[model samples]
Target: MTDQDDLLPIGLEDALPARAAAITRAMRAVLDTMDAHGYDRVRPPLIEFERSLAGRMQGVATRRMVRFTDPESLRTLALRGDMTVQVGRIAATGLAEAPRPLRLCYAGEVALLRADQLDPARQRLQMGAELIGSDAVSAASEAVLLAIASLEAAGLSDISVDFTLPDLVDVLADEALPLAADQRDAVRRELDTKDAGGLAAAGGQAYLPLLYATGPFAEAAAKLKALDAGGELASRIEGLEAIADRIGGRARITLDPTERHGFEYQSWFGFTIYAAGARNAIGRGGTYTIRGSEEAATGFSLYAEPLLEASGNAREAARDTLFLPLGHDTAIADRLRAIGWRTIAAIGESDDPRALGCSHRLEGSEALPV
Candidate 1:
């Protein structure tokens, strides 16, 4: 092969053996947990017609998609940049008549034209669950709780969740301090950066208190209530409080009422999950409306790469592969597997099992340390 053919494009990567095994194990654990919770698994295509994938969500930018023309159909096709959108499409068309509060889960790879600052890889492994046909608080609460459980099942510890009211700014601005679109954008940018002065200068003084209302759930809720904002703003805060109450003593929970980025489509509540050692968020999701319909859905997608990084225990456990001698008994191999050992039979003569990345080796009737 030529040198050019051997090089991979920027933002793309090949997951080597160790990392690949860890990712597979993590994803399987998460999917199994979701299945236990009654979330039916579904596999969506990696590519679809451009319009169908984009749907009506304003957050799904066309430039971020890797698009090309299909030769056979003479139509534009694009690699899916977000699996949530595909799941939404599935609920709307294929599973439209399934049932109320349909629970679905999916895990797949998505390619993006650009990556965010926190996650630099454009190609990502996204594993998540979605609940459709219900906008009730119970649905949102269940999604959040299930996400925490899945991350724990993947062997992550000290997991914490930060809740965001994506529509809080708009609700406050519309009711208390009406501003033009540009002014609202400026205020949002200021709030995102925690620039109190910029927010006040941009005619968002009424919403300035939100800058300080970010911390532990109870403390932040108290500060928010003190802002004296009533109507929908109050209702949104109450909803967040309700979610917190439901998730009590399950996982560490915090509140960030002013966060607006990365949740362009979420309607009421948005959230992000963090682990003890990871440098970036492990997952994020919230309540959103499937485009062209009023059905409310809530779910999250966990980034496998980062989760695997934070889960040191998972990596160590994945490395415990056992090497079996050539022509070893098949029944013994089956029994070893039943006891939670990953055994690989030797194909040819070899002196060292370590050369083949096996931690243990089988000798006669008993397995010996390598």
Candidate 2:
């Protein structure tokens, strides 16, 4: 028989000592950056009533929630699969009477019923900031810029931002195409795969130019304008351009107008942040309407696990800790700690401070390099 101690459920694994410490430090750094930018920190519960958590949100997939019944109340409660929705609920009910454009930031562990092919872990550490009650292009711009800044503060550089219009399909559908559901799906598939020939064959010739509009900001913007997609589509493209202009020289910006997989609920501009050597998006954000209310908001959630992996140097460079010998004055250790040193005191006699992973040992009153 298999050993029970060695078994763990699929998509569940422990983040051992070094990795866990690194993840926490990286998250704290990003949160501190957000806090410095006037975004107040908020901590929502890990579980809430399913109705309140899922509540008619476009992007939240209710079926993927890990739900259970509360024993006392007998009401269905769900482990928060996504904090974005919870933030929206807080804004609508708890902070309903608060001022417009409330800025909030949060960080916590989210449990999902299943994992995507790209991200096999169902449990993940999520850190993000939400700008509620504003849908202006400026708000979107702020969200994107702040996301980039936060990642940089967390020791990630060479970041790239990919912008997308999640409602591009709806925008095209409103045109006089009159294609059936299946036909539209086919066109979307073509666009998603960047199959120019297939898209043209399926009455998507109007969108064919967007396939080539995938590159650096200026080039993509020029190609997009050349398409002359007037009305709302043109307005959306212009918003993207405005954001790119504001984000000048910070990091690389790219446009993928036809892509539409991740932003299920985003109505206008959506984006994904990428870093060199990271296999998945470091962060994602977009604009969406809060369910049960007319409030429009924009925000981004950064996945800490992949980001920690990408910042390999930061992960390995934990603070240098000093090991104190037994019978050493406690006041001495306190002074060392006050000066930003991590002091590990010896409880029993042990000469090998290196075994405890300490970089230095207390010799006399000073900490000498071991």
Candidate 3:
């Protein structure tokens, strides 16, 4: 019964009825949560000029996006790998004059030409809110809290947030510790690997203490503060504490100050949120400056695909479903439907109410149990 020609691409699959319903439910909850916070939802086109798409973020990799020459424009067009960049484009161009600290949220599909080792899917649903015009401690705090709220709204529980100072090295290298431009990347790489010897060999002996600065927020922040011999990281450390205080018992907090893995564009204050059953981060966000507009912003994006696993009520709920027999009154059926009953009209006498997935049957203007 299976046709070889009908096979889908490696990382793409059809979301059958049940799964599609769950995806819709999850996406609606996330968008509603953002709307409740006054963040307007935006729908951006799935394709854009490669140049425009890559110019918004400083280190965006346009090569990873699915690209082709547009016949009409005769220029390369790219399928977006991230929607945050599109939100930035909207804020800078369309909403340039729209008040400061503009709040916008979005939910859409993003595609990559090739799949990542960590996340095998080439296409995924990305939902997030961007707070344009500020990347201050307060903005960072709001972004973190809102992200946690969005996950909770989607029915995810037991969430934990891991914090990172995206610009930790640059901040320290500017004063407390010094490193040549070439040495900075090496130190960051070693720190990411947690290789103590590699860090020391890269002229980052002063950065060795940063290696131990991982774990609970309180303990890790203390270690980072103590290692700030010249007070280079004092402001960042305090900012982290202020944001953590606002998070307060909402979710578990941890710190990994030198984490730059998924934060190529994040300036500082990046966070990755995890849920109980998810094997990887469910969402990530941080503060960063838009490249073209040069505007400051803080935001987070939650991948809905992963949230599906951690959510308990992903299945469609049982409701009042009514079956209308072939000879049933159309007026009565309409009234039942208007009152919130789901109705399935029978086209033939052989149609069974139970077979049609109905819980009730229309009988003389009354909905009787099927």
Score every model by TM-score: 0.90, 0.91, 0.97
List where candidate 2 sits over 4 angstroms from the true fold. 176-190, 193-206, 229-231, 316-319
lDDT of 2 at 262: 74
Which of 1 and 3 is ahead in lDDT? 3
lDDT of 1 by residue, 1-370 (tens): 8999998888899988777878888989999999999999989999999998887565887678899999999999999988988888888889999997889999999998877666668899999999998756788899899998998898887888999988777777766767777788888888887888888898788777788888999998888888755555777777888888988887788999888788888988999999988888988999989888768888888888779878963654435778988788888889989998888787878645888778888777677778
Error of 3 at 328 (Å): 2.2
Error of 1 at 58 (Å): 2.4
lDDT of each: 0.85, 0.85, 0.90
Position 153, candidate 3: lDDT: 84
Off by over 4 Å in 3: none
Error of 2 at 226 (Å): 2.0
Candidate 3: the clashing residue pairs are none
Best by TM-score: 3
| Root-mean-square deviation per candidate | 2.6, 2.5, 1.5
| Model with the higher lDDT, candidate 2 or 3 | 3
Candidate 2 lDDT over residue span 1-370, tens digit each:
6698798888999988888887877888899999999898888999999888888487577788899999989999999988888888888888989898999999999999978777779999889999998878999999999999998988888899999877776776766344556678778878888898999898888677768887887888778777654555678888998999899989899988877787877888899999987888988998989889769999999998779867863656567999999888888888889989998889787567898889998987888888
Which candidate, 1 or 3, would have the higher TM-score against the true structure?
3
Q: Name the weakest run of 10 consecutive residues (lDDT summed) in model 1.
A: 312-321
Best by lDDT: 3
User: Which pairs clash in the backbone of model 1?
Assistant: none
